[model samples]
Target: MTFQGSLPADRAQSYEEQRASPRFALLLRAAKLVGAEGEYLCIVRDVSETGVRLRLFHSLAAERRLALESAAGERLGIEKVWENGGEAGFRFDVSIDVQRFIAEAGPYPKRPIRVGVEDVARITVSGETTVARLRDLSRQGAGIDIDRHLAIGQHLRIEADALPEFEATVCWRRHPSYGLVFRQLMSLEELAVRAFRMQPGRLR
Candidate 1:
């Protein structure tokens, strides 16, 4: 149930300093760990070709291997290399194109560009379907207003006219408003086009 990799005396320091490939800080990027018990949502703090650092909301039981799925549709086979508190480090079976992934997640902006929306969407979670309102849209994810409450790590399938059906995970929630990080990130150009078509008068 413990990580096999060596740990530093002070784990608080950035581990990227010792890594080969430079890691990029991810914004609004989410990943899921498909473990033996079930899938768990995690925030992808940083990612490089060889591995990634994930922040899990809850403690994970010991597992030898797991699959990690990025918000950009990239899936990697991962083995737990290290762990400290809620954070864990993983080693990938194959190296990933970190630069390409950063580009697809959108420009390295302080905040992602968000477009206001009032579109109706259908969300399917745990075999249940519900109608939700799209409050805003961005390349990484969408803000949804639904009547039902969802667990922070729960996965859902979103379907809307302006958007293709995509997989998503609940990153955060407040009352009726929930923040979701998409399983596949849409390009900036694609988001802009959708915004123009959906809200011609109000493009923000």
Candidate 2:
């Protein structure tokens, strides 16, 4: 679904750590979820280090217990953190260190090629307007183009293809353009878009 609405600049928390590149299995199960009103069958949609984004048969009350089982058939603990109409987001009772797992995935495979990002992103701040483009992107940060006139500490929001709407602050500016770190880093799914474009058929 395309979102064409104005959102608060600080609506969401920023991504702090470097993006993880590990691929892990996720499962959707038909099981009853427990809450003040008792239980309802909910579908689990895999797991990740930070949390689980799943589809539920019935809407769950905020802060309820939804059973999660790992791919190893071990039940994992989870708590409901967000509900968007029907789909829910949960944070795991246990956080997995995905960075260690990725490092252990053998020597990092050489990236076939660097993904080129020439698309322009429109940015709006405090009713003021500016434009930026995807110059280069790594899992850690993305280079953008903006006027040097924009204050370095000013916060900016970006809209672009294949990226969740995120907020960033001016970190470095050079004349007609500047680079801003993804205040919230891209997710594995988002990273995959660039990775796959560089190395075809590597995903699956």
Candidate 3:
């Protein structure tokens, strides 16, 4: 059968294309399986049963096998789907355990919060730091505009007065702007309260 510009809705299968799924907040680490490449810590904005988008401060090899480790230090195997200078995507070897994640993110704000990039501070994987404005903030994660294009799995520290400094990874980059998945999200309620109150907004 010939396909048109978009696939037929009824004909669509249960499984969606890897690139089409929405992103989420994920916490994981990457360890190089071969060569002298060192292990890189990473994070995800969101993930699917099959794949994930990650951020690495250091360079990662394409077509190389990597060990994806959980916050508890559990490990899994994954293959690089794509990689640019400082960001990449990988397909997980097996479906991940979805229950481990708990929602600590606040509800979306009614209006876009206008904050400078410097309001949300960032610490590089190498310990370098900068103050950035928060373009957007959510209970799960926040988007900050920074000059660096962090690698998909690289680890770094983030700090804001509203919330304690925490670690996270780069999920993707749109040039000077990039997505961050909070590496350490302990309580969604706390995150939500802080994010909402920081700007002018009511709790949802």
Candidate 4:
């Protein structure tokens, strides 16, 4: 279940001896660890094809199996293998293309570069579809205004013009405003180019 600190001395030595892949240091990209307790923001410290190391703000007792959503739009099932203070390491359920992900550079941070937009988007949850007003957009997620109450962590699909229809999970909510993290994050450069190409009249 939960790892409080570094691996035991004997195990640490064994772990070091068994390494098969080289790990690449990360650049403080944002990520999320979803466990039974809830979702917690984390910074990726390094990555390899088979595993990742993360820097967490606080300690959490998470289940052995958890979902890691990276800013680069990677959703990985990971098992905690080691921990030390604010740092932890996890092995992926399936090996990934480490170089491909590392090159993408993840999504943009929330708020700072979000483009204000007025677009009608459809939110589908459990076969029910509701129209929501897209208030602002970012590569990682979108802020939408909707009348219906949505529970945090509810899985849904969003469809809108100028944006690819994608699956997302409700991450934050405040009355009519809800923030959804996309299951597949768009490239920051792609989003910026699209926003810039939109005609002035198209912006709401």
For this target, which candidate reaches the highest TM-score against the unseen true structure? 4
Model 2 TM-score, all chains together? 0.37
- Residues forming the 10-long window of minimal summed lDDT in candidate 1: 195-204
Which residue pairs show collisions in model 4? none
lDDT of each: 0.72, 0.51, 0.53, 0.72
Winner of 2 and 3 under TM-score: 3
After superposing candidate 4, which stretches have Cα over 4 Å from the reference? 1-18, 105-204
lDDT of 4 by residue, 129-189 (tens): 9999887666788889999999999999998867778899999999799998988877645
Worst 10 residues of 2 by lDDT: 14-23
**lDDT agreement of model 2 with the native:** 0.51
- TM-score pick, better of 1 and 4: 4
Over 1-204, each residue of candidate 1 has an lDDT whose tens digit, in order, gives 155565675542334433666778885565556655444556678888887888765556566488875555455798777777878888777787787666554333335556566678899998899999987777789999999989898999998888889899999999699999998998755775564444423333
User: Candidate 2, 108: how far from true, in Å?
Assistant: 17
TM-score of each: 0.45, 0.37, 0.38, 0.48
Supply the TM-score for candidate 4. Answer: 0.48
Candidate with more favorable, higher TM-score: 1 or 2: 1
Clashing pairs for predicted structure model 2, backbone only: 15-184, 26-46, 27-46, 28-44
